[model samples]
Target: MFNKWQAQRWWSENYDRIKELYNVQRLNRNAFALPTPPISEDEASS
Candidate 1:
């Protein structure tokens, strides 16, 4: 698990890329069966 500071830093550094990947994953998941778990349930609604 990440400490609070490390988590914050990682989010700041990777949020945009993470969002892009999450969207791609969501699209692919909808199109077919995907084994990967979701990034977050909150993201799925947006």
Candidate 2:
């Protein structure tokens, strides 16, 4: 199929860039969902 071949060609040409972008997006998503560190003992004691 023409669409399939075109997709394949595009992927071959741009796979590395696509992968890099996907990785960056995934890292950003994970960073947003992650929690902050807990306060230290001195701060809690005060």
Candidate 3:
């Protein structure tokens, strides 16, 4: 369930609020923040 206008309003009010509430300011400050990619087994072993 997603409404385009509602989404816009949420972000328009203040983009920073999203980051502050999620507590990921240190990890990511982008307006469109995404989770870190998963590491493969080989990459993790190295």
Taking the candidates one at a time, how many backbone clashes does each contain? Answer: 0, 0, 0
Can you write out model 1's per-residue Cα lDDT over 1-46, one digit (the tens) per residue?
9999999999999988998987744355466775697679789788
Clashing residue pairs in candidate 3 are: none
Residues 1-46, model 2: lDDT tens digits: 5598899999899988988987844355566686878999999999
Write candidate 3's Cα lDDT for 1-46 as tens digits: 6499988888888788877888765544575687799999999999
Best by TM-score: 1
Q: Which stretches of candidate 1 lie over 4 Å from their true place?
A: 24-46
Full-model lDDT, candidate 2: 0.81
Worst 10 residues of 2 by lDDT: 24-33
lDDT score for residue 46 of model 3: 100
Candidate 3, residue 17: the lDDT equals 83
TM-score on alpha carbons, each prediction = 0.46, 0.43, 0.32
Ranking by lDDT: 1, 2, 3
